[model samples]
Target: MGSRFVNLLARSCNGGPRHFSLHRMNPANLFHPTRSAVPAVQPLADAPLPPPALSFGWPGKKGELAWMNFMAFGRTGNNFLAVDQIGRTFFYDTDSRSLRTGMPMMCKPIMDPISIAVGDSLYVMSGNPGPSPGKHCFQALIHGRLPASDTNDWSWYSLQPPPPFVNDIPRFHEDEVKSSCGDVPAPYEIGAYTVVGESQIWVSTAGAGTYSYDTVSGAWSKVGNWSLPFRGRAEYIPEHNLWFGFTPNNLQLCTSDLTASSEVRPPVLQNMWTDVVRPKNWTLRDASLVPLGSGKVCIARFFVTHSDNFEDMSAYKKRENFAVLEGVEVLKAGWAHLRMVKHKSERYVFGRDLVIPL
Candidate 1:
């Protein structure tokens, strides 16, 4: 129920600094900056807050990284991509959290887009119309070379009549592709989407079940281990690999072949750890996975978590400030950089990723 985020936005249109009208659960922690180390400090004895991490660049456009509706990617802190409430998406380099500019023409009206970093390309797929569920749009990870050959020429085109929708698409491939093949994968499988080992697509469903899409054969198959439970499973791509969230209940991470695999696993955090919060019904909140320098990645996991029982609805406000999870890669492990989207007052704060006191 704590879905609505960003009481205030970045580059706000106010006279002073941006002000917000939302409450968040940011644990109290003080920033102790040393030589490459952030020693943590506690405000009181009750809550032991973690330390802070290196401040990477913002994961937004115009050097802006404050968008309520955004998304990010992965473990090593290498890639982080974000999509604002509007349809615009941003790709940032993790090291500096800096925006990378090389591939041009990234404007499109994609609703719910699935991202995958295959080989050298960032494939973005699916999206119907409006914010509501509808049709699907397809775009290539790698841009085709245009004859014009200008940096500005780099962009994606709309591939309509895309993978068939779960409802309207055929049940079997023999009837569709005419290959005498078995069941083929439909392009659209509702909101179910996944990325696996470099390149793969896995779609999870309640009725149709889990299945993988074979890009080459142009077919689909029921996923292995049908026994695996599916609660609030969601998928996204920032860069490098595919990300799948099995049961939003704790949201243990699992990876597999691009075509979907039977075995699934949980992801190790930047600091390689998990807290006491119970993850449930994960909606693709604000995400932006960017790679910092020195093999480090920073992912701002902006999703929501709730009690196993619907008890503590206090945090569930119709409006809330920007709650972000900033992941920073450490020496042997990784550290999370948690802080509130600072207000001009610097009095109120939002909480999440915090570097541990060492």
Candidate 2:
């Protein structure tokens, strides 16, 4: 067993009085299904609420955990897949609250790779390969699958790279390129990706364009000249028949009808919500939306707390890191209006570990 998993088990066993109702309980408490040692003679009506399920850390030193890319996998969405810059893979099962090492990636090491989960399989796309003089461009596409029962049988296989035109988009003027010796333009990186329905994986580039990859035919096709309105991974909400994701610049929670987008037009954002009121000094580092079935979603935001000191900004004692987890329920208010009810919010002091939903 991984050390991280052991630590989680220990913490769970030592937890104080907790409610039996799963709805009000912390999701992390569900990790370990072990019953309490001493049964309560009578329910403590005023028992303190348990800590958020976001306390555990990843398997790495401080700062190293930020380099890894994470995605929720498996049929129950209880397993999380994490891959680092050096091709190392880790599988974490929330049901068992255990971490297991998986096979290394077949492609070269990618920094902040784009990943998406479709059914039981996971697909990874382009990223910065390395920092060498000529190897600084974004490239590579591959995927891996979970074994039916044997964990050791898990592995990855290479897939065809995106079309060459994706990299031909000019980043600088011809005259400027001709004047400079080492000012080569880097290839376009993935801006966002989501699985459409069941067989199609839609990808949007930074400014190049949008494209679709057919998982069944193993073929790629151009979607349109415009890019997806949101960034990173978007989750499909079956109840609303729309995809929910964060807007590119402001990190606002937004939803769009991807089915309406086509080669003739771009995706349209139907609704947006300012779910969190953040401070000016706090820098938003990352955000993810995890759908918890039945029109409910969890939003996780990681922030870097900046110091008031302007001079000597690099001082070690000037900064702190933390994360906020908020729950929201989306409902239909009328024929055309959608209502979002914000629930309780939990804050935790962030560290090297990445708080991705299992």
In terms of TM-score, the best-performing candidate is: 2
lDDT by residue (tens digit), candidate 2, 259-330: 998798898888989845557788787787767767777776767676566675574344655556665678
CA shift of 271, model 2, Å: 0.6
Question: Please, what is the whole-model Cα lDDT of each candidate in the order they appear?
Answer: 0.36, 0.58
- Using lDDT as the measure, the top candidate is 2
The residue-by-residue lDDT of candidate 1 on 108-189, one tens digit each, is: 5454455554444555565222122333355553445665675333355444434433543335543443211222333223
- TM-score quality measure for candidate 2: 0.70
